[model samples]
Target: MYAHAKEVAEGMLGEANVKIASQNMGGEDFAFYAQKAAGAMFWIGVGNQTTMERVRPLHSPHFVMDESALPIGAAFHASVAIEYLNKNQWCAA
Candidate 1:
């Protein structure tokens, strides 16, 4: 991930909640965007500790989403966008 993008995310999400994942060879479509422009690919954790046993990895046939996390994810996206624009002196309008 771009350093600026990562910094923005950590600032919005809190450093404690931001984890630097080990580099992996997994193929992702976001690579295309990254090659063309500044971009980031981040994961929002949605597993509830109480029901973690029932959680399944993404793309699994039994995968289940924790709907409660929707609002949090939405807010994070908005925060990142607003912060990025502000830092760049660009209006979000």
Candidate 2:
């Protein structure tokens, strides 16, 4: 899926306008995802600043972030939600 998204993005927009960001996978969350079906998952609450910081170090105890990255995360999540809704034929109930 990531590869396909990258290909489409690059085809539609120049490489300069496309940024590919993939999260580092695997952690305690791996166990959670394994036990459930594809869609069932969990949410962790970390400050957006903290998330941006910790994400970079990959592994560390004292992680922090600036608040400014919130909008990007929100937009990314919104895009994902819309994709899922369309793919699964979901509607508000």
Candidate 3:
């Protein structure tokens, strides 16, 4: 599943720009979706800004998502969906 998704993602968003997220400790419950059908979840980087000489964690008062990642995330989803649908005729294109 990821093999195809990664191919589509890297194809649309250059191989150099693609990044594999690390440090996934406790797995996400979202994996349950795969049991019903082929499914995958991916991450998009929102960048970190230095705050008080350190990078703050998520949900912090100063934490903010870099808007630049929005377009990339949108494009990634579109590309993955298009590619997957192309391989399988889930519905009319």
Candidate 4:
């Protein structure tokens, strides 16, 4: 995961036209993809509910989140993106 993240960071950021935002110093989840797509937004996810509820979380013993939550999160991200673009005249740019 770290290697993949580093690869993305290097590939995307080495470009002069691509200005990188908050790297957040690690501890990121797969959620980073959604966040980065939304201008490096950062978020915390609990766990994958679709996965075996009987099984443990990615790291912790007690953490958990529903896969259903992902859609809601995506919606939130879209709304935020719209709001930001509207505020900054991004579309006009």
Candidate 5:
């Protein structure tokens, strides 16, 4: 699952563009969903690399996301869904 997601993401974005972040100690609320089903979460980079500044850390004041990655994220998401459906025959016709 991780490999498929990573490949789809890298294909839509780029090799260097898609990064696997280091593991974090903090847990996400999404963990609840994983208890019921197999799943993986992706984090898209939305930082302002141009400014190289941090207005505030995540879950803090003034945290914002760059909308520039929307198309890339959407493409990756579609690719993942299509690939999974094809592989699993979830909507085979």
Candidate 6:
């Protein structure tokens, strides 16, 4: 992710919640999109830690998500967008 984007995300989501993942060899389509535009892709914590035993890895048949985090994820997206736009003066356009 771009440095500015990461900074924006960290500003919106507390630094403790925003983690900088180590570089990996994983293939993601977002890499192509990012080549042409400034963008970022983030993962939200959807697993309920209290029910760790019930939680399953993504794509697993028993995979389950804590629905309560949905609103927080939504807010994060909106906050990032609004803050990025405001900083870039895009909202005034």
lDDT of 5 by residue, 5-92 (tens): 8888777777988878889888788889878976789976667767756645678778886778677778788899998777877543
Which pairs of residues have clashing backbones in candidate 6? none
Give the poorly placed runs of model 3, Cα more than 4 Å off. Answer: 48-55, 90-93
lDDT of model 4, residue 58: 59
lDDT per residue as tens, model 6, 1-93: 366656766777777887877788977898898889888887788998796668797889999899898998898778777876777784334
After the best TM-score superposition of candidate 1, give how far the Cα of residue 80 lies from its true spot, in angstroms.
Answer: 1.1
Please write out the lDDT profile of model 4 over residues 61-82, one tens digit for every residue.
Answer: 7655567657755754565556
Worst 10 residues of 4 by lDDT: 1-10
**How many clashes in candidate 2?**
1
lDDT of 1 by residue, 1-93 (tens): 357656776777778887887899998898898899777887778877686668888899988888888887888778777776778785557
Q: Report, for all candidates in order, the number of backbone clashes.
A: 0, 1, 0, 1, 0, 0
Better of 4 and 6 by lDDT: 6
TM-score of each: 0.79, 0.42, 0.75, 0.37, 0.78, 0.77
Best by TM-score: 1
- Candidates in order have lDDT scores of 0.77, 0.49, 0.77, 0.50, 0.78, 0.78
Model 2 TM-score, 2 decimals: 0.42
lDDT of 2 by residue, 1-93 (tens): 344344444554457756544455656655575566443232222345434534544255665555465675465455555665566685678
The full ranking of all candidates by TM-score, starting with the best, is 1, 5, 6, 3, 2, 4
The residue-level lDDT of candidate 4 at 77 comes to 54
Superposed by TM-score, candidate 2 places the C-alpha of residue 62 at a distance from the truth, in angstroms, of: 3.9
Model 6: per-residue Cα lDDT at residue 19: 80
List ranges where model 4 is wrong by over 4 Å. 1-38, 44-65, 90-93
